[model samples]
Target: MRILRTALLVALVVGVSVSALAKADAPLIDAVRSGDVSVVRALLDQGADVEGAAADGSTALQWAVHEGRAALVELLLGAGADVTATNRYGVGPASLAAENGNASILERLLDAGVDPDTTMPGGETLLMTAARTGEPDTVRVLLARGADPNVREELRGQTALMWAAANDNAAAIHVLAEQGAHLHARTDNPSRSPGRTFSSTPATGFTPLLFAVRGGHLDAARVLLDAGADVNDAVSDGQSGLVVAAANANWEMAAYLLDRGADPTHAGAGWNALHQTVRTRRMNVGFGTPGPFAAGTLDSIDLVRQLLARGVDVNARMTRNGIRDGQRNRFNRLGATAFMLAAKVTDVETMRVLLEAGADPLIPTADGTTPLMVAAGLAIWNPGEDGGTLSGQEDEVLEAVRICLELGNDVNAANYRGETALHGAGFRGANIVVDYLVEHGADLTALTEDG
Candidate 1:
């Protein structure tokens, strides 16, 4: 916005200007920055150049805008400061005003005939800047003055609408959309990150509707839908809004999408909403989550119920995503069932929800690893939580083991390795689960194919 905020700029400009003119008469720049009106007037009277730049190419006018000094901005402009001067990041006075939503300063710059279409170094225009900063009023003023809402940023080809959608700025989104923003525009050449669900699609495949879901902006999503966004629209990989909604644990959005005709059973990249809904962290999270506390166990449980009621395949399995090795990888080796994924997680509430919703506890994968064996084989403490007494966590995992046994999953069932659920527990030091399994008739002498 301001190239950087004052707090950060203060840190960046730790010493004197590291420039060739380190000893030049740069008091006008320093005075304007400190908001010392008397010193600024004195510098102007002393024939100081009003358009002088700092080490980073930031002109006095740009610094005034950053400091929110409206009077100083006007004074500098009247003293022949160039409104078009920019900083190292190509952010000028006008762009800074719009980004900060400083309407008064922005009006003066716009009235001075500044071109609103000019972009910063990264192709961010005034409207895109305002939208990213959640500034509806600035967006309205710019649009009214003939700013192009559909103008694509040069780098990512994102219009102001895309930025609005990404930031959850529903008001800005509405303003831009009403001003003729393109609804179905896809980003150009999106960055590729393999470790993300949003990356299930290739670059250049994200639409505004998909971005809304990715941002978890329910109101913005509804606005787009009411404005005629295609509910069934998907990325190039066929990751529909419904699948994203569920995968992101956005139950309300998922519900709305289903009501709007999104396919509840749509699968993308060999996985469905069921796989994402039950996943504790990896798939459903850690891939640019909206916020740290945005997803929760309660929401996941609710989503599980919603998907089940909407007729998603409860025993839906995702093939083992990639090559697997090591005995501890058993849970993932055999294509994972939703129940299996949930059992390996500590959130037993979600596991219970799936179980109650008719997820088969004994469903086996290609290698014969069932959800029961997966739960029993899980380590009592996560690697991060190792070296602690395993009582609390052991109880949680044992809850899944108990549920599986009570529901008739074989206590002695083995995987392709011939390792029983009891053996699985024994491998991971799940003594509590081992005792329960043995009490339920688990064979003590079972051996893996390796043994």
Candidate 2:
């Protein structure tokens, strides 16, 4: 009975002591978080736990470094705080310092024996983090302290220079380049898994220049180009810088790339920048009311003119087994020209531009689908599923049909499937186009090959 009483008394005393210790440690963390140097010193003097962590596993020293409290950081280190302590996110004091652009604090941490090349949980190095901050001093400090400028992250194989370029950090890009970062380092190429075909997988081979162009960072792109980055470098999918710019309707970037010797005729299989530009514009700017034209529309027109002036073929056709094969509706077909693509979307303005640039409206696809057939909504294989209807685009389709007819397309012409523009209009339930076709002498007796 006596021993049981003594054990109970001792347990009670130990619980009280542990609770007191926790109470003492809580104030130290709060003091560090609030940047109270005197309070932190007093807590340490009172034997507060220097390594006490908040709920997120952030110790006093880590908080000090993150908050840029150099004096508190020094005091904590003197109190035997762990410099290598990390938060639950795997972010250590050094990484926080780098990400915050506190070069002096980073140097102090490095001097205190933190590994300069320490990576995050995902293998992102301090230099990569600093580069993304757009601070040249932090990047310089990391590089000077032996952080590799060319070191790639484990997941994407992206270097510090790539990160800098992606974030529009031109100064960091310049520094990384001077430190021997690879000018054309690409991300890891996407691998085709066992059941996945190459076309089903997305392209992942993006260089620093491509990253800059993808973000529309003209200054970063210029820095990379002047540093000898390849202007014509493409991803695994063959999308070059010019094609990317065209796809995004970035006329300025496209013009810049063209001036820097980007091949206007460079094609990914059968699709060129012109095709991308027209297709992208059609998707972004749907057929609205006839316009005085938006600023973006005018810019796209200028880009088209520039592409034509640079010698892009106005009548270029998609190849038999091209990059966009089996992708969707009319665009999936072979021998389809840019004019036909514009026609399919009922983009009368683009069709006019193509005609002015000498595009042949009579050119047909491999299936003998003419620009007129496409304009009348006859080219879609599955009219119900694909965007084949001229429901709201009756005016545009009528104008396009008129343009095709005026350009000498025979209204009675039939595709290889024996389907005429009338059949196309009927398939899409476009009574407006059907009536117009009938008025234009479409052969009502025409029958498809199946009939």
Top of the candidates by lDDT:
2
Which residue runs of candidate 1 sit more than 4 Å off their true CA positions?
A: 1-25, 30-42, 154-157, 188-190, 193-204, 259-261, 281-292, 295-298, 319-330, 333-335, 346-348, 378-392
Clashes of each: 0, 1
Model 2 agreement with the true structure over 1-451: per-residue lDDT tens digits: 1232243234324323334335436688668778888899898998888987665566778768767899998898888888887766677888878868898888888888888789876677889888888789988888888887888776667788888887889999999999999998888836421111212224477789987876667899999999999999887767778877765556678888999899988876467778767665554122231211222333776788899999999988867334332343343458877888788777777888998999998888887888888788775454432322332367877888888888888898988778888987887667888999999899999999999
TM-score for model 1? 0.80
> Would you list the clashing residue pairs of candidate 2?
378-424
Colliding pairs, model 1? none
Tell me the tens digit of each residue's lDDT in model 1 across 148-230: 88887665566788777877888888888888888998777656421134323445656778788875777888888888778
Per-residue lDDT of 229 in model 1: 79
Model 1 global lDDT (CA atoms, 0 to 1): 0.69
| Candidates' RMSD to native | 5.0, 10.0
Question: Residue 95 lDDT in model 1?
Answer: 81
